[model samples]
Target: MAGKIRVLDPDVVVKIAGGEVIERPASVVKELVENSLDAGARKITVEVEAGGRRLIRVSDDGCGMSQEDAVMAFQRHATSKIRTAEDLYRITTLGFRGEALPSIASVSHVELLTREHDSDVGTKVVVEGGVITQLSSVGCPAGTIVTVRNLFYNVPARLKFMRSPASEFNYITEMLIKFILAHTDVSFTLRHDGKDVLCYSSEATGGDLRSAVAVVWGSDTASELIPIELSTPKVRISGLTSKPSLTKSSRSHQVVILNGRFIKHQGIALAITHAYQKTILPNRHPVCVLRIDIDPQLVDVNVHPTKAEVKFANEAEIQRLVVEAIELALGRTIVVPTIALKPQPKPATVKALKRAEDAFGKLLRSKLQIGTEQTAQTDLTASKTHAVTSAENVVMVTTPETKPSEKHVGIGISGGELVDWHEILMSLHPVAQLHKTYILAEAPNGFCIISQHRAHERIIYESLCQKETRAKAVQWLVTPITLNVGQAEVNFVVEHLEAFSSVGFEIEHFGGGTLVVRSIPAIMVNQPYAQILRDIISELMLEQQMRTLEELIDALRASVACKSAIKAGEVLSIAEMEQLLSDLSKTEKPFICPHGQPVALTITDEELRRHFER
Candidate 1:
């Protein structure tokens, strides 16, 4: 015998249904704001306490609901945005499912006060946990004000999973940024815990999108953005995108608005990123606010509960338009290369300077003997052993001694015999630079190719990890750079000021969102400090904000190495290439770069013979 299935209680069913529409405090804010927008509200005010867990109040100047409709607004499946079944296919409003008001009312205590412009009296309705507790006529302005309190009180499970107040506030702030940018014509004011955090007046008759973007992303970032505009037979795309010079470490700043509604469409995101593939570095995302206007019939907005995702009829067409618009906009904008600061000599103590001079003498003497091109090939080939196909032929060398005056000039030998390998990598004469990027060298067996940038990056990254190397003398700036940033970014930079100092950057707050960079790492003096500092800060804010001091130093070190390393197109002399290889061989992890890219590869003689059909 099987147990009989029973229907859930009416109260339990409503609460369960509410969970689908309202997952967190940010969801509640999103739904309410969209409703206000749909009501044709030109002016709106949003206030929250305890990150919307304690109270949320939204006031709008749109036309208020009538007495009869006010009572029906909380009932399931009731809505004013749609009338017939066919209306679902073409949703022009930000919300049309009619699930927001009722679902929200089911999970919290709701108070609604409203009045019509022609009516003398208004209606006030109070609801708690899906029950109508009170209703009456009242005197009020010709608008609507909905206040929600004790969210998720009826469902303890949901309340238990709510994030911290600060985390919740960040999410609410991010959601509002999207809405504010999407509907620039509507004025919005947001208050948290009695303090006004964000305020945006309604745009003028013809307002630039840069003004709106500046309100959230700071004016510095907005000024660097380029306007993207494109029109097709069936679509019109217009927005602002950051120039290739201004990229972000994360995709958080990219906003996509479709048909005046904020959405998260992956196809559109991919198109925007693809446009920047050749301009920006790998793993970095561009910042853009793209608005796509397509016929309502060609899109389905009801696919997701939150309506953040939409299904396009022809996604490929939309993608093509987006890519073309961004590419065209970028082609018109000029991107000048950043100029590096003047090079400066590194300061050293008396004893260290004496030892360095001795090391230079030793290096010069060894170079004179082994660096001759003819001697290099003959001596290297003489050390080659027979049967190169044996696995033991690949010999591993020990990490080079770091003593300044120490030198290993003789070929590595075991049992008084000339082995097939040498300890010093500089002994293998570098043949030439391959396209000015890779160091091509002839080893005892076959050939070794090393990526100059990746090799140098690994060396600098390991150097920053050691105490001796980090005692790195600093190069003081003659004219300090004063950076002005937003309040959020300012706070982040100030908090991590000490972390910056650990990696050989000297910075001091100059009051009111301004910081002066007084000095930088000695080795990086000739690199572009302005761009490198900003990039490091942005990357730290994105991925390492919560990291420990040690972790932050390591992360910044890797970033500094990449920025200061030799670029691919730049030419390097033979001495510079030899120095790069020698430094690379001394690093802890020499084969791969800090980013996990292979630094060097070796082609054994056996494989070379097989390639020739031996």
Candidate 2:
């Protein structure tokens, strides 16, 4: 028999459509809170129990609904945000989909109580699983209070997919933080399990967003941020960005607000990253609360179901403005890195050994057998290695031991002390820094240039790797330092406490979103251990997505290498350059950084002569 097609039941259709908007407990919070914001609410309260699975409540002091409007609000496709099709294009409110209320009501047991300021009585509507069970007049305050119980109870399949209580709560906590940051004029209070978790007053800062940021991310981090405001003929951008010295591992710290709504756009993020090119490390991202205002007609906010993503008609132009804004803010910084250089005696000899540099070096050389001694100095182009180009000379080799996503390159160092000029590093006397970035040296081959950051990164990476494999001991602190982070970061630290301990960090909870660091790794001594640890944790969080415990330690090594490495734009003394070259020669992979960036490049004397036509 042939199968016949039939339309689903009306109730089943409503539930299916509602599931799209109310996929998880966090989704419910987003819709209801956005409704509160759009309703001209001055104060909003959010309470949840059992990670929003058993109960969810949202109350607001705003224009409450009338008896008639309260009943129709739960019907599908009913909205007051807009009326005509033209209104959709110029949406200024946070929510205009007309699906949140009805969709939410269809999936959970919902109770709505509302009373206008002029109304003598309030309306009470009880709905269970998209069906209206009761409706009557009730006494209530002026505003709206929505209570949802047993979310996803009607759909056991959806309920089965919910994450752990703590994880779900983390998502809700993060969402609320974003809303609070976006609206400084609205007072927000959040409670979990009957305990007050967050209480922010709108009047506390006099409408200052930085004060609001301070309340969430801490005062020290707030103080380190720079203000950004730029205007073009077509677009305007205004926001706050942390200094280059302050960065996190993930892009999660960056919040991109499009027009008046929160959105995620890759083009804008790329523009900001390009602006911080040489100042911040590649793996780290700056914390920014960027708001871009463009003509509503030039953007589309209906791209995603949750409205977290948006598309711009002139994306390239908008990206340009984002870069210019960040650059303008960074240009005003008086960043003068102080470098201490002590005079060191020059060596009498420079020589090369025929044997490989290290155990790893031996294996690399024997397996690749890349070039002969005579051609080694001449084959400097990118093709001889993996994706090695003439411009960058990058060769990324991936091994089982290394991260699959990370690129790696092999380097050859002329081993042993020298009595004669046979080594590349020593033979090429390092003269000066080129724009305070690359080291200019006179090499026997022709010229030797070193990337200061990559060179230092290699040295530190190898040192940390050794320490990790050897079960390094912690260097106890005389005065313990306390680190302040957000609640989510604190939870992450608590969960990975043992991982930190394995890397020689002795930290413990000190109550109130603070962790006291009693000791740290010996290699990270004399540096800002607190900032370093934070960076390490940030890096670990990213790597944890695809890495195991053993792999996490390797990722930690890379992070420590980047953090402790000497930064670009730093003035180096002659002695410092001498020591850098000397120390670099001793590392296992002297020519490539841990992240596979080239530490040094050499141009042969013959190639130089050919270019000169000599």
Candidate 3:
């Protein structure tokens, strides 16, 4: 009889251990690059071919290892960073476990060339599938060079799970960015397929984080970044945070480099959010690059394999430190870019644009019953077009100041999709504004109530939808508005500028995470165009926000309508009320707004009787 679990072979054990550390080319790069930084490397170069499936070479100019040390490095649990068990509690170096080299070598063919500065010659060691195949003395530079080839060739299962070459390369690029941002003292050059993709020279700025941020995010964002510095007994925090105006839709732009390694802490994130609560909206996240130096004894880096996560002794205190530092930095500066719009010569086109804007809410002459009541008829037809504008829009509406005549109006949307709702809305006679928020109306059956804000939101939403074509009205900003939104949004905007153009926004990339807006949808021109751009980008960047290219234009329309819609507290004249209800009747979904909020609620005669117990 055999035991259910037999001891695995040496090769099997090494390969299995390697799987834990070397998941992809990015993982390989992460481990090797950290080793270079740990060796006090001043210059590091990473080269990849075929997204690291063919080869990955990481060369660093630092203190290299001797021939004996080069051979011993392939063995597991051998490390110069630590010696005893007690050292695990106070782990300071990035590569302390000493498993990175052995694990990487076990799953791939590796060649290491190293020479100390005082040594006349260097040693070359080659490893294949967890075995040292060759070791020889060679002449080389006074540094270390690690070349990995045919990664995961022995593990066909792992190779099958690899993503596309470009995707894998992107992952590698993203990982390198973290290392580059974490260590600004070292110069880094990354090449893919023999083309220089990114380069950073440490010769300039001498470890200025703002300069690094300028390289990664952009100079515009770096210029506006506020420096934060604070020292406590247990924690020292120093880094840069974006101004109140410069923020990202997501937290990916926020980075917390703990000690010398990048990490994520929920308490720290909440602290950042709390600090900027008064300045930014709840949904928006401020961009930050913070380095928190704390006593090693208080942190447990052994909690994760990759050391991307850490455990703090006093999380609340650390969070408080971060919050205070950021808040203090924010209080110290009040600088924002100001733009002076270039004056445009007012021509006949100006009047034409105004008239077009005014015509948005101006209803064409039509006969419809104001109410289903069989009482009387009054002449209230004199006031044809009256401005019923909100504080945010120049909407005009047609109403009666003279006489009333029989007029007609006419949605099948079961909320998600479309049904017939206009018949019921058309019959309701608006009585008066209740609390200046809702409109009370009378019906033949019982009565109806409408939320003025939601009703206008629906009206505006449909109007924007109707105008979502090349025929859209474009309001050109005299002086192009430039916005520093960040790398992710910049990539998105550049890739989908056509989507923006299709809906009437003429935006172009102005280099380095900055966008210049030449024009915007005429409907949203009066609103804060920059903020609108930010908000739209914010919403569109949300997970699953865009399903197809068509939805891109739809999102623009919806965002613009929501911003341009009338709100509560604005007093509406009778003409405005009638025009609003009349417009709502014409929409595809009159029962609910674009956001799915109820525009109007109706009580039938039966329901009213039941409520009153009549």
Q: Write model 1 residue lDDT over 181-216, tens digit each, in one string.
A: 899888888888998877777655234578877776
Candidate 2 vs candidate 3: which has greater lDDT? 3
Off by over 4 Å in 3: 1-19, 22-25, 48-56, 105-111, 123-136, 148-171, 334-351, 356-468, 471-524, 527-614
Q: Mind giving the per-residue lDDT tens digits that candidate 2 earns over 193-247?
A: 9987667789988768788777667666788799999987768899899889888
* TM-score computed on alpha carbons, candidate 2: 0.69
Output the number of the TM-score-best candidate: 3
Better of 2 and 3 by TM-score: 3
Question: In candidate 1, what residue range of length 10 has the lowest lDDT sum?
Answer: 366-375
| Candidate 1 vs 2: which has more lDDT | 1
| Candidate 3 lDDT tens digits, 449-541 | 888878877776666566442353556666777787545466467657888887668898876567888887655544566777776875665
In model 2, the worst 10-residue window by lDDT is: 344-353
TM-score of 1: 0.71
Provide the lDDT at 12 for model 1: 92
Q: Following a full C-alpha superposition, what root-mean-square deviation does model 1 have from the true structure?
A: 9.3
